[model samples]
Target: MSAETASTRLAEIHSRIARAAQIADRRPDDVTLIAVSKTHDAESIQPLIDAGQRVFGENRVQEAAAKWPALKAATPDIRLHLVGQLQSNKAADAVALFDAIHSVDRLSLVAALAKAMAESGKRPDCFIQVNIGDEPQKGGVAVRELPALLAEARAAGLPIVGLMAVPPVGVDPAPYFALLAKLGREVGLTELSIGMSDDFEVAVTIGATHVRVGTALFGARA
Candidate 1:
């Protein structure tokens, strides 16, 4: 897309966010929209960066490793967020590539990340992922287990910055987002990464510090 087209679309997305914030009696600046660039090429993201989007999210570590190098070569200061499940083996690569990881869900992953951080000499900011829906198959820690998880990550000198969650597929997400915000406060955290393409407005209204939006920004992923 042309820079003009990208700028127009981004403006529209910002307008929607502004409107939603207004409806919730919020300042638009209170919410940071993280354009999810998981399946998108670096070509697709340049225009977005030119249009003044400074933050972007990626789902898979390897794809990010491939894309981010080129993207960063062009836009050196762009902030990269990892919003996907990360495996132990991939921890070093992820620590090297991402500025933040919003999917720290298990004790083992935490230990692996600590070891990787030591090896890489890079400490990526992290969020504790909460399985709020309590689905047996999901990839987050049980909500009740978060404090212990945060404690362990902190002891490793990781910047445990916030909490993240993916609400169950067809349900209302507001309550869950609110729960995260509450948990963040209880834990003295400053970030809450929640919501996505579908319910980001609700998240902003309920005090989400970051919202990961993909399809709404880039069209549906293949």
Candidate 2:
């Protein structure tokens, strides 16, 4: 996409976000838009960066490692987030690369992150992803197991920031987003990392502090 197109798309999404925030009586700035640049290469991503998007999300550490170092070196304020399921063995790399991790869902990964943080002295904020829809293939801690996961994350000294969830596809997502928000509050987590391109406005109404928007901002991926 061209810089002008990217800028227009970014502005449109921001306008929608502002409208959503207003409807919910929340400040638009409270919601961070994480432009998920997972499969898109550097050439495709730089246009968005040029459009003044400072925060980006990637699904894999390897993909991020390949593209971000050069980008970050040029624009020092850029923040990268790991918004995909992470393996325990990649904890060190994730800690070193991402400013926030939004898919921490298991004890083993928690332990790995803790050790990596200790060794590297880098602690990225963490979000406990809950399988709110209880989907078998998704990478989130089941709803019943959330409290224990939160406790373990805290005990491990991980900076547990909030909860993240992806509602079941082809279903109304409002309930799942509301559930994730409720769960976040119950656990004393104020940050709700819910919503995406299609349903972020609804998520804002339900108190999402972070929206992972990919397609809307970057256009449909190839």
Say which candidate scores most in lDDT.
2
lDDT comparing candidate 1 with the true structure: 0.88
lDDT per residue for candidate 1 within 140-166, as digits (tens), equals 999888888889889977879889989
- Candidate 2 Cα deviation (angstroms), residue 129: 0.5
Q: TM-score for all predictions?
A: 0.94, 0.99
Please write out the lDDT profile of model 2 over residues 161-182, one tens digit for every residue.
9999999999999999989988
Candidate 1 regions exceeding 4 Å error are none
Model 2: residues >4 Å from true position, as ranges? none
